[model samples]
Target: MHDRTPHAAAAARYPHQSHASGPLVDVSSPEGGPGQHGNTYVQGFGNLADPLAIDGFLRIQEGRVNQFLQVSDRRAEAQRSALQQAADRLSNIANNIGAILKLEHEAIKKQLQEANAKVDEAVKARDELRRLADGVNWTGSAKVSDQEIRSKWKQLEYNIRSLASVLAKCQTKVPSDKLTRTRLDEVSTAWRKLLVVDDYKNFLIGAYI
Candidate 1:
């Protein structure tokens, strides 16, 4: 150990402080501190443990500790800000999804009401046609010609068949193999062949099973 009485005044210059008190100022640096400057050692327990030397070493260590804490605090604050931003983004996304769902629900309800109105119109048309047919007595001399009546009835049958075909297609889900009883109105041969294509198979992935 070496006496530090000479540098006592210099030791008191730093801002950091330490409350440690002991009989040693045993620094780990070599005789010159780990560099090529000069030397610092200890004598017996008295001069080595002088309050000045002890206080100086403690102040230097305190400065290092304070610096590390400052850096750590800055990093912690940055991480907290990042987490808050992520949470806000997720909340906005959730609200947008809810808005979209509400719009879709309203649209579907409107479509249902229109469909009901169309159904009522179709029933009225059928009733009117039945009354007109009853007025033309086939038992006696018919008011309307047989050929004209046959043509009209055939047209009505064709319309009914077309409607049935459309309904069958709408009711069936994609991946039709899942159904135990397969039933669908026939389409053109060329259109039916396209169902086996890879593109069609890929398109079916998004469809309801």
Candidate 2:
């Protein structure tokens, strides 16, 4: 007959029984209570009656959990390090870009200054050419002597050559400039006219001599 004691009933009624702990004991039968299998006595609630077995299982679970936590921590640390390295590289790239932009700005400023100087020089050359052209004494009074006319003709020839030279220089400096090209064409036309006038004057002087 099975013991109907409260202690035996409580032990039987305990939860967490499993055949995996060891072979299950048929505690419900009077002939099968507290049966031993090898060195283990697996009772109610699996191996709960054996404190050492329960402790060993808990320790194994604790070790597995700790190992998982360690692996996770290492992975997290590696991720953090990678992120920091990427941030550092980006910062370096940004700094390099800023430096490059600064250098480009300085170079552009220098180029602009050089361009302005060239423009000023070209303008001065154009003004000087205009002044020289205006100073030429092309037509003299009828009272002027032939010798005075010859001297004026010589001076006019020199002045025209100077104008051509100045115009050539201006053209070289601003080859793409439409205004400089137009001025050069005008100067070339005037020089051709002067050549014809020079020939006419020499003929008149030769006849008079």
Candidate 3:
């Protein structure tokens, strides 16, 4: 379509992502041309003219049908644009989600490292307290906080799985919205003509089907 925006760079990079390509013949009546009840007609279809004159007359006739082609191209291009927009929108959203998940994953890893350090510190302190009690008859409980260390370990485990699940989900969502056609047997009549149907099947409908 002349007035429509050209496909964006990102969309252009994925031309094969479009489910359909090319405009179809519309065969519908023109807006203000001879097809308006045939009141207006091509200039010289019946005239016995020279070759150049016949070509000139054919150009005039072609003008009448050009409207249908233009309108159909515009409509088809609009449909393509809508699908591209959907894919772009979904990808952008998923990318943003992935960025967030990455940050959270880093935070979770840091937390796990800190939790492991705390566990090691607590184990050393408790061992030292037991050694001192055995040497000097001191019987006080160890001061290292076991509950606090376990809580941190539990939180670290939870965050590890949560971050992994988030990344997996983002990966799954980002690539599924692209336009991909597996068949064309049920496409519209005008589109079928462009596809050149043969024996109740359009060759474009994929042989695997």
Candidate 4:
């Protein structure tokens, strides 16, 4: 009869096998297989099951994220400062423009006032000249006969010659005396009246001549 125990059965299945004659395979080394290369199984992540390695990677990513956030904040602050500066410049420009406009307005207002004053003065002078002209015309149009005008003209000529002689004598003799001065003023006034009458009679004699 054959032995049927478990160890006798394994010996009967591989009668030529022995522990020392088998090839030794290293499972931990990637070069142990024909298709294996460096880090082929892990895909260069380096031990995905390790907590310390994952934590280090996470900490590096967090550092990068924080650095990016800080850079973004600084850029935003700089932009806000630049915008504020631009706004301040615009405000100053607007104020300067407003001041310029105000000055121009004042200058125009003063010019208008001066123009109005000049216009008023010219109108008053023109009116005064017109009144004087009207008075001369009215005086020339008085209703006097030609005979009367000729007689008045002769009398005025005589008075003018007599007054001129008196004024020449007084100027030579009593030029500074108060009584002589008064008499000279009266004589000058009478001479002016006689001259006015002479001019009127001349206008009347134009038709006769």
Indicate which candidate wins on TM-score.
1
Candidates in order: C-alpha RMSD to true structure: 18.6, 16.5, 40.9, 23.1
Higher-scoring candidate on lDDT, 1 or 3: 1
RMSD of 3: 40.9
- Report lDDT (CA) for all predictions: 0.55, 0.57, 0.53, 0.57
**How displaced is residue 201 in candidate 2, in Å?**
43
- lDDT for residue 18 in candidate 1, whole number 0-100: 49
The Cα RMSD in angstroms, rounded to one decimal, for candidate 1 relative to the true structure is 18.6
For model 1, how does the per-residue alpha-carbon lDDT over 1-209 read when each residue is reduced to its tens digit? 65477345445654354434553464435554543222332344556878998999999999999999999999999999999999999999999999999998877666556545544554555565686687556577647766866766665554444443333333333344523223211222233344455444323311211
TM-scores vs. true structure, each candidate: 0.43, 0.41, 0.40, 0.41
TM-score, candidate number 2: 0.41
lDDT of 1 at 33: 51
> What order do you get sorting by TM-score, best first?
1, 2, 4, 3
Predicted candidate 3 versus true structure: per-residue lDDT over 109-133, tens digit per residue:
7756664564555456555555544
Show where candidate 2 strays beyond 4 Å. Answer: 1-46, 49-56, 135-209
Error of 1 at 64 (Å): 1.9
Clashes of each: 6, 0, 0, 0
lDDT of 3: 0.53
lDDT, model 4: 0.57
Candidate 2 weakest ten by summed lDDT? 200-209
* Candidate 2: residue 21 Cα off by (Å): 40
- Stretches of model 1 off by over 4 angstroms after superposition: 1-44, 131-209
